[model samples]
Target: MKKTLTGIFSGLAILIFILSIGLMISGTIALRRNEPVFVFGRAVAVVPTDSMVGNEPDSLDVNDMVIIRKATIDEVEIGDVIVFQGVNGSGNPILVIHRVVDIQDEGIITKGDNNSSIDQPSYQDYVSNDNFQGIFQTKITFLKPLSQMMSSSKSLIFGGLAIVLTIMLISEVIHLVRTYQDEKNEAIKKKHEEEIEALKEKQKQEIIEEILRDNQK
Candidate 1:
């Protein structure tokens, strides 16, 4: 029973490790492409700015991980926080997360919770099905901080992951070696017991022959 449970747990751990690696690889690729990572149509994003942060403790802050899902333009309403791609000062695509304050035929107006004024009208001034990714559904805190650290030093993170996988592999190898040794020991013990039993039977026969010879005399 103990061995069975151990095997079950080990299998589960390996499965989890594989899944984690897959997620990390996919997430890295998506980030490099500046795209949202969708798992079953739900997108995951790390909050890069504190624009949505407020004085409340429950408010979304920098490094908070947000899960986004696709929504139509007609489904969007005022006061809903949305993530969209916007051009930065350098004309590069950047993700912006803010709440919609007003809805217009052209586009939606957005502002940060902590900001003083609304964002200026520009190419990103309106929300459309093409540029709009989705609305934020959940906020996971503290993971963003860890993600930032990992992003800053990718080599270290990758090295650590490599080390962990190596350790797991080594552990499995050790378990196999130990199991083989145990089986080998059991076989040796069983052979020794058989030889001892054979010796005892031969002695019993010799005693019976000696008694028969005395009776014949």
Candidate 2:
């Protein structure tokens, strides 16, 4: 039972470790391509700016990890926080997460919770149905620190590899322990068999002596 439990736990740990590495690798690739890594229609993002920080309970702070789910334009409504693709002042595309204040025939208007005014025209000019990404689901408090650590592609890769190495080391230790136990058990078994053989020989010699005495009588 103990061995079975150990095997089960080790298998689960390795499975989880592999899955974590896969996520980190895929996430790094997606970030490099300037895209979100979607998993089962959901994507996780790390907040880089404090634009959405406010007194509201749901306000997002910098380094917060959030989960977003895919949504359609028609499903969007006023006051809903959404992620969309926008452009910066230099015409470079960037992702923006803010609350939708209004929906117009052309597109939607979004504003940060803590910002003094609405987003500039340049930023939201390209915010259309095609640019819509997903709707905010909830913040993941536990992953906030990990998300912060994985801010860059290099760090993400390094952290992932480090974890993989750690898991491998643990697995090796378990394997060594099992090997030692098996060897110890085999030695004990051999010693018991040798002692039994010696006892059988002694018994046979005593029986022969008794038979010779009976024949002499």
User: What are the TM-scores, per candidate, against the unseen true structure?
Assistant: 0.55, 0.58
- Tens digits of lDDT, candidate 1, 1-217: 9998799679867865785677568766765666665554566656667778986443578767666876777788887888887776688887788888898777888887887777648545576766777887877664565556654564644443334334444466568768987999999999999999999999999999999999999
lDDT of 2 by residue, 1-217 (tens): 9999899778868865775667668766766666666655677677778889987766899878777888888899888899988766687877788988888787888898988888746456635778888899888767666767776665673464345334444566577669988999999999999999989999999999999999999
Please tell me which predicted candidate would have the highest lDDT against the true structure: 2
Off by over 4 Å in 2: 1-29, 152-217
TM-score of 2: 0.58
Model 1's alpha-carbon lDDT is: 0.70
Q: What's every prediction's RMSD, in angstroms?
A: 13.8, 13.3
- Which 10 consecutive residues of model 1 have the lowest summed lDDT? 157-166
